[model samples]
Target: MSPYSPVAEPPPRVAARLRRPRRPRRGSALVRRAASPVALLVLWQLASATGVLSPDKLAPPAQILRAMVEEWHKGTLQAATGVSLQRVVIGFALGAVVAVVLAVVAGLSRIGDDTVDPPMQMLRTVPHLGLLPLLVLWLGIDEAPKIALIALGVTFPLYVNTVAGIRGVDRKLVETAGVLGLSWWGRLRHVVAPGALPSFLVGLRLSLGVAWLSLIVAEQINATSGIGYLVTDAASFGRTDVVVGGLIVYSLLGLATDAAVRLIERKALAWRLA
Candidate 1:
C-alpha cells in the first residue's frame, strides 16, 4: 500500500446529546384544555347578559357562578356534596366487590361461567333506570334504595371488563405457573391479577360515570339532599341558575374522579414505561 494510501478515519462517534428536558409549563395543560369551555362560557354569558337568549330557559355563567357561591356560603352545597359523596363511596365499594367476585368465578371455572353468565348477561340488558319504581316500592324512599340503585348501575361494566381481562391472560403463562407448582392464589396473583388490572381500571372509570348517573336519577325520586336534589329543587322553584350550578358540580366531580383513575393508572402501570 502507498504511504499516502487512504487511511480510514474512525467512524464519527455517535454522540447522543443529553439535552436537558423541557421544563413543564405549569398550568399550561389546564389552560389549554380550558380554551373551548371558556369560549363557550363567554358566549353563554354574553347571550344571557345581553338578552340574546331567554334567561327563563337557561342561566348565564355569571348567574350560575353567583348561585353556586350563594349555596356554598349557605353551607347547602357542602352538605349536599358530603351526602352525595357518602352514597357514591358506599355504592361503589359494594358494586366493585361483587363485580370482582363474580368475574373471578366466571372467568376461572367452567361451572361458574355456565351458572353466572347467562343471568348476568340478561340482567345487563334490562335498563336499570326502569327499576326505579320497583326499587322505591320495595325498599322505601330512603337511603337504602338510592345506594342500591347506584350499586346496580356501577356493577355491570366492571364485571364485564374484569371477566374479559382475566380470560385474556396468556394461557401459556398460566400453564407455566401451574407446571412450576404455583398454588391457585399464587397463579392468580402472578399471572392473572396483573393482566386484569388495565381492563379493570377502564371499567372503573366507566362504572364511576354510571354511578353518578344513577345517583342523579335515584335522587330525583324524593331526594331531600345531594346535588341531584339541588337540581330538582331549583327546577321546581324556577331558579335556572341554581339548576345549572348543580350540573356544573356534577361535571366537576366526574372530571376529578376520572383524573384520579388516570393518576392510579400512571402509578400502577409504571412497569409498562420500562
Candidate 2:
C-alpha cells in the first residue's frame, strides 16, 4: 500500500441515500390536523347558504355560533360550564384515586384479587343510567347523587385497565429484577409501573370521557344548573340552536380534558416513547 494514499470515502450520492426524510414540525402537523374541521365549517356554510338543509330543524352552524355567543353574553354558558367542570373534576379525581389503590392491591395479592374482583366485575356490568333512579332516591337529587354517579361511571375503566396493566408486566423483567436481588417493592417501582404506564394513560383518557357522559346524565335530573341542564331545558323548549351550542360546549370540554391527560402522559412516560 502507498503510505501517502488516503482511504476512499463513500460517494456523496450513497451518503445522501442513507439519510432519512426530515419530519414536518409539530406546528405543521397540528395545522394539518385542523384542516378537516375548517373544511367541514366551509361545507356547513355552503349547505346552509344554498338551503340544502332545513335550518329550522337542524339549525345552521352559523346560527348555532350566534346562539353560543349570545349565551356567553348572558353568563348562562359560563355558569353551566363551571358547574359541569367542577363536578367532573371532583368526581373523577376521587374515583380515579380510589380505583388505582384498589387495582394495584388486587393485582398484587391473590387474596385482594379474590375479595374485590368478582364484585367489581359485576358492578361494571350494571348500566350506569339504570342506577340513576336508585342513586337519586338514596342520595337525593343534588350534587351528591350527581357526583356519586360520575364517580361510579369513571371507576370501572380505570380499575380494569390498571389491573390489566399490572398483570401485563413482563415476566422476564420481573425475573431479571429478582436475580438482581431487588425486593418486591423495588421490582414494582422499577419494572412494573413503567411497563403499565401506556395502558394506564389509555384508561385515564377513557375514564375522563365516561366521567363527562355520566355527569351529563346525572345533571339532567332536577338540575337547575349545569351544561346538561341547559341542554335538557333547550331541548324541552325545542330550542335546537341552544341545544346544539350546549352540546358543542360539552364536546369542547371533553376534548380539553383528554388533551390535558395526553400532555401529562407524554411528560410522565417520555422514556416509553424512546
Clashes of each: 0, 0
Best by TM-score: 1
> Alpha-carbon error at 15 in model 1, in Å?
32
Query: Model 1: per-residue lDDT, tens digit, 152-221?
Result: 9888888988999899988999999999999999999998999888778778877888888788789888
Each model's lDDT comes to 0.84, 0.83
- Candidate 1: which pairs clash? none
For model 2, where is the 10-residue window of minimal lDDT? 1-10
| lDDT, candidate 2, 1-274, per-residue tens | 1111122223234455688865766668778889999999889878878999676667778889999999999999999999999999999988999889989989888999999899999999988768999998899888998998889888988899899988898989999999999998899999898888777876887888888888878887899899989988988877888988998888888878877876887688777555
Q: How accurate is candidate 1 locally (lDDT)?
A: 0.84
Q: TM-score, each model?
A: 0.86, 0.80
Off by over 4 Å in 1: 1-34
Residue pairs with clashing backbones, model 2: none
